[model samples]
Target: MPEETPAGTPEGTSTARVGGTVDVGGLALTRVGFGAMQLERLEGDRDAAVALLRRAVELGVNHVDTAQFYGNGFVNEVIRDAFGDDDGVTVVSKVGATPDPGGRIPLRLAQRPEELRAGVEDNLRSLGLDRIPVVNLRRADSGPGLRAEGDQVVGLDDQLAVMTALRDEGKIGAIGLSAVSLETVRRALPVGVVCVQNSYSLVSRQDEELLRLCVEQGIAWVPFFPLGGSFPGLPKVTDTPEVLEAAKSLDVSPAQIGLAWLLHHTPNTILIPGTADPAHLEANVAVGSLRLDAATLRSLDAVESRTGDIVLD
Candidate 1:
């Protein structure tokens, strides 16, 4: 469990925090943010999860990534229970999928336009809030694995139409995207996408083109698999020799170096590294302070990029 901290943000975290700032729908948030999915894995330990989340906010984390489908709305429940409409953190949730217990991947696509609206409502109900600050339309496109088929194959415009309606109605404050291609993002540009989440890391640079596009378009680049994934045949940044060397030299963990690299690799880049452990949560937020020198950056940049079989969304 994380060591408990007092609830005080803005003046508290911003005063001595190293996590830099980024704009999410005009909200200046810590670039190194927290992802709340690990709380879902702690099914039998709600208090510990809530405590950890509270600690994250106490440590200056104002941007949190979550999903109503995570633990079938249990994650958002944990968020509500932990923060209770706290405005210090920007609660960003995703649509386009729901939990599938005992299924192949534990998640099935919900890509229909109606399903999209229902997903937004599900987030609102779960988080105990009428307005979700930022919602990502997790399109079933550019699948690292999951794909849409039959009636699940909804068009971009169809999904955005409902998302825009929700935004107009104040159901969601802004919009984001995941598991998308450059062309798909280009098409969604008219709707004013605030951010784009994808599977990107030091080892996996396949989305460099998309990252550049986001930089040019002023969209926030929020990468999910910042340290890569645990899927078989997938590459992990911690397992790389260069990252291991950098950590040894800097007296930090390889995972920290991997995350720090992401923050330095591009502008408007935000990271949502999640953990169930107390120490790991603090370490994840501290990545913003880990600096990479020219030599370290060059060595890491020289390493080959590996997309592997990790999920893209």
Candidate 2:
């Protein structure tokens, strides 16, 4: 848990509740939090990364999601530099994977017990947090292992043991799972789950069942890649004709409509739309304020539920 502090936001900044609060390890978090994946040079330009993070907090985002593997500590450093000792913020970071020094994405899984411990330590040193509010174990692959595999590598039980030890030692407040299937989530629930981070959006509803489970269980559902994947030909929820029409009718942007749809679809759903542009960051926060009516929501649901060949995996 973050240290006690004032209630108001930074100077000239404002906050809007995207939805009601949900408790994560006794911490009440806003439904709309910030994803710090864009705070890296993977997509190019560190200046833009810094600007977006600063803009996110300035727009009243308190819950922040990051991972040590994201840019190999660069993203966490960005968060530390932006919000230094602001008790109003909660930083949730993950371990399990290690990024390749020569590239932007992670190389492979190194989630042994010792590696998980080291990852948590590195995250603390990078983010300057003594206790991470939420620590998620990010699995490298989603589906089942090989048929002939013996003594499965990176077992969920093993990972949960490490996380349980960390929580018992007061190193982390809550534990979560990321980039895994609903089966993985169900298996880890015995270890006490607080959140589930998955690649979910209008275009990619592969984890819809898991999302509904989180809603029913009162666990926070943090959706990464909310805009669907990389740009140029990104399969975005905002690009759908139904979403565009709903935005037009509501006099709001398509992005805002997408966020509104997620906010209304489930109370436990938390949209983490990442952007490197400050203007886009402000606009993304404004999404929390847009409310879609029943008619527009039904139209969006109909269009989005139609299965297409645009797979996110």
By TM-score, the best candidate is 1
Residue pairs with backbone atoms closer than 3 Å in model 1 (clashes): none
| 156-239: candidate 2 lDDT, tens digit per residue | 788788899999999998998877788888887778898887766776677788887887777788777665643234467877
Model 1, span 86-121: residue lDDT tens? 457679999999888877678999999999999999
Off by over 4 Å in 2: 1-13, 17-20, 42-52, 101-107, 141-152, 230-234, 304-313
Instruction: Tell me the deviation in Å of residue 100 in model 1.
Output: 1.0
Give the lDDT of residue 74 in candidate 2: 81
User: Candidate 2 local accuracy as lDDT?
Assistant: 0.72
Overlapping backbone residue pairs in candidate 2 total: 0
Best by lDDT: 1
Backbone Cα, N, C clashes tallied per candidate? 0, 0
